[model samples]
Target: MSSSRSRRVEYDRFIPFRSAMDMDYARFALTRPSRPQRDGSRESPSSVAYQKLLDDCILKNRSRILAFKTAPEAPASKLPQFDEPIRPQKKQQRRIPKEPERVLVIRGLLDDNVLNLLDWGSNNVLAIGLEDAVYLWDAANESTKLLQPAEDRGPITCIRWSPDCAVLAVAYGNSDLALIDPATGHVVDGMEDENQAPVLSLAWRSNSILTVGRFDGTVVDYDFRKDDMFICFYNGHRRGVCSLKWSGLSGRYLASGGHDKLVHIWDACMPVSRHRPRQRQWLHRISSHTSIVKAVDWCPTRSNLLASGGGCNDHCVKFWNTINGACLNSIDAGSEVCALLWDKNKSELLTSHGSPNNQLTLWNYPSMTRVAEVSGHSSRVLSLAGSPLGGVVASAAADETVRLGLLQHRYTSDPKIELEKWCQMGYNADTF
Candidate 1:
């Protein structure tokens, strides 16, 4: 076979061009003039056919090589033009329902520092300070107004608002006792006796008020309309009384706890005709706490239940039954229980701690179990109160910051899962 005709098969299997030099050289060699055709003789038909075949093979092979090398020149199909679909972030909201705004008002910032506070019914909050001033806090608007008399005595240590929320009784230094109207800020009556050193606590039941002094461990009861001031004296505590609480369920009965580590229950019932009301009888005294009792409160829902804390530096919380004055249980809070409060619903016991560390602990009431420990204050925690209608809790500290927080509880509903599935379709947790 002729050399040119035989080369056609080789062109069909052309090698791919790898470099620019190889490609250019191959094209140049194919186009260059063939060797002097056999002494310039006129080529025969077979030679012409062979020469045409060789040229055609060279052209086809060169085209295939060039096509292989330059194939990338054409613009790529440009990957489907996709924009990563934007994902929307989910907004988080509180789990509980929104509640009304209830505020705590600062009545008077006393110079000697305010030590005690009492809520007179649902309308008024009583605060006593070292400036010989008695402050009546308007609970509705969270504001404070003074209610001191013209003959203002010494700094008040104890204050009690009548069950009717109409009058206030103040117990102060120099063994003085006075009754003042909270609304008009006027003193209706005043009495002084040298029976006790200084009154530390005051409690009111019906129309009579209960007062306890540091000089004697006496719980003195006094009536407003009586000519002579004297009620039955509770001498069960060997040391001065520190705190007192009257049961709202049975206004005629009360509870008192003091430094003697004893809690006494009393019953004050007098005939409606008695001009000078008689004394209340001491029903029982339960000695349970190892140290001084700082504060005592009757459970709002449970008629016979009471809670106490303070001075028990080792174990700071305790629950008891007022019926028999028997302690139900105790909890070790690792500090002095400066203040103890039962929530508005009486389902929780909030305890405040003093120096070294400031903390607020929420305990399941009566059961004596802790539910949560809140820590954000740099100073001692002084007071704690919860909203009546909401899950919000307010705590006041010596640090001057009143913290407000929601009591968070986890709840699951069937709708939540269905909604999440509909929203998340093909996505997962990692997509967030």
Candidate 2:
């Protein structure tokens, strides 16, 4: 039986990739088809044909494969050996964050007193503080001087500088107004008066001064050129009047907000008879704040839009339509607002809280949502202003610092350098 099994085994194969020791593993087997005779006698021609077809198919597939079972062996030779295995090298990488072309900038110092109110006149600004002193700042030159009049009997409550920056109107917590020439740091004249209550807000129309206060709850018009005497006092607000602003675009309309939680619009003009300074007839009385309205400002671009803020005893800043007194939008700041500024270029609303928190919060006007908040001040923030480019914002607080920065960078290039060169050439021509 062993002899018969040995004769039956077929071997024409190659070994698998393993150590060459044990050779009894299964190997490839090659089979040859049995040829048929021309005379088919008791055997089947169909089986022979089928076997030949299967063998041909197997040979065809084997030829297409890349790897083979059998190959000629290489000659033995000595080669260099690497002690370390081939390892892939990793490369170092660096990632950088993108920076803005123009950054939002803010910097400032503390004020000696809790600034009651703030005002901007042309390239200058005024801050009315606790000592009946009105501090004027030259915005372009970054200089400041205190305007404390000889007759200042009470703390300055509010200030308004003329649009042309020719004269500065000062109002004390008590009834009085001082017109000062910042150029000479002297009182202009006829501004000393003690008959009215504290002037809460100051405004200017054509060459005259308009002031609002609690004495009569009326709008008082003062003509400093004609005389120190009052021109017209029109009763408008039922309660104390606290805020007033002129339309920078038209210079024809005046806006005032009062403790009555209403905003009054006045047509600023001289009456036909000139008896009253075109009486402020209270065109629109807007009511949105539940408590006293603290401040109000007319848009510089459009004469029909007004922005107002109130210490939240009402909790929000509101934009109102000047003609219809309709509330357009409200931003919830969650703090008592002491100051608010409208950045014309970026359309951002900058608000400062008086108490509870001394943070300055910036809001996107279009979205009516808070965008960024600065929490560096330890005291209440009283005033805010944005640069023309709208890249930087300046805020004044109970702490005494005036901050300046880029609102937006037109470019890293200096805009003034070229202008300076042109000016030098012009100077040389004039000298010749």
Candidate 3:
């Protein structure tokens, strides 16, 4: 009956439920759908409005829905037609030709003597020094003629043709050097030695300058134009100076080897007055050889490159960079390397062997691979010379025979081609 009690009773009556369990029936009745007016009934206003809202959303986002189904692709190039013509690739061929023919041969050269008696002249004439006689064989006509007949002086020790091939420098056992006319076969000039030792080796620097290697281990350069006066004198080898070569490419460097097991590279332009009594104009005193160093030659193409071979005790072919006196390469020749000749047209080297093999080997220089081995001499092969016209090599042996044969040129044809091939394989020139 109080005022607060009357307000609480009025609130409870308006709310109609005192707990959640009392409102469950009303909540279920509200969620239940109304009965349809007929079998095919129309949609309610709220359901119609929700359907219309979905339709509106789809119409507004039509481009976005269609964009996922119709994405653009990358453009493609047009292909060739089926009837188009195709091009063919070209094939490569070998560069070097086949082996050359064996031109000619001469027998009974020195009667089984191991001597440096064979020399090929630029005039296509081959000179052979046999005991007391020196014969000139015309390679073109296949004829032999005596340039110097048997002399009283010691048998011919060495013979070298002048650069012009017009005169011959002959060394006799009587310690005499004679410049003879090849046409007349007569001595035009002569020089007598004081020691009377045999001149074992001879090389012509020019038509006027002649270099002689003596058995007394002396190297003397004589100027024939100046009354055969000695212009330069070098004494370094303790034994006989057996080999001497003036570089044809540089014309300023001279290579000498001796029986003393020494290889001396001399600069001809060096001043002799600057040295002492026993000292000489030797640029490099190379002592790589253990035995007699008899075979020495300058590379025809490389100015500062030199090649030398040791005797039976040391059968090695050594290549030297003469500029710094550095040995570039050393190859065990398996036998005494008696002689070496460089190819004129290719990067090849021909070496003659003695003792066991007695074979003539054609090598790809720098590479040093033996390309061909020719064995015809029954004795020690001593000397080798390349033809001035190229593609031929003449070798002389202790068998008393001179053989002319073809040197293989397969891998030595062109240096540029070899370089290109090496580059493709990741190799350089120094790799050899």
Q: Which is the leading candidate under lDDT?
A: 3
Maximum-TM-score candidate: 3
- Expressed as tens digits, the lDDT of each residue in 240-296 for candidate 3 is 888999998869998999888999998877766654633456899999899888788
Q: At residue 144, what lDDT does model 2 achieve?
A: 60
lDDT of 1 by residue, 139-241 (tens): 3454567665445456666666666666677767677877777778777786776765777777765666545545467676665567765655655667777
Candidate 1 residue pairs that clash: 232-279
Model 2 alpha-carbon drift over 4 Å, by segment: 1-116, 124-132, 139-141, 212-216, 269-278, 386-392, 399-432
TM-scores of the candidates in the order shown: 0.60, 0.62, 0.70
Error of 2 at 111 (Å): 9.9
What is the lDDT for 55 in model 2?
48
Query: What RMSD does each model have against the real structure?
Result: 23.3, 20.9, 24.4
Ordering by lDDT: 3, 1, 2
Estimate, for each residue in 1-432, the C-alpha lDDT of model 2 and write its tens digit.
255555666779754544432232113332332355556654567666554554454332232222334444746544323344435666634211122111211222224222235555555453434354556555445456766666636666666667677777666655666777878877775454466566666677765555545534677777666644576665568876776667878877787777788777776553434465455466676776777675566666667888888765876788987777788888777877766776665566677776677777667766877666666556666666554333445566666543333333331256455233223332121100
Q: Could you tell me the TM-score of candidate 2?
A: 0.62
lDDT of 1: 0.60
Prediction 1 TM-score vs. true: 0.60
Clashes of each: 1, 19, 0
Off by over 4 Å in 1: 1-115, 118-121, 124-130, 148-152, 209-214, 268-281, 382-432
Locate the minimum summed-lDDT window of 10 residues in model 3: 423-432
Which is the better candidate, 1 or 3, if ranked by TM-score? 3
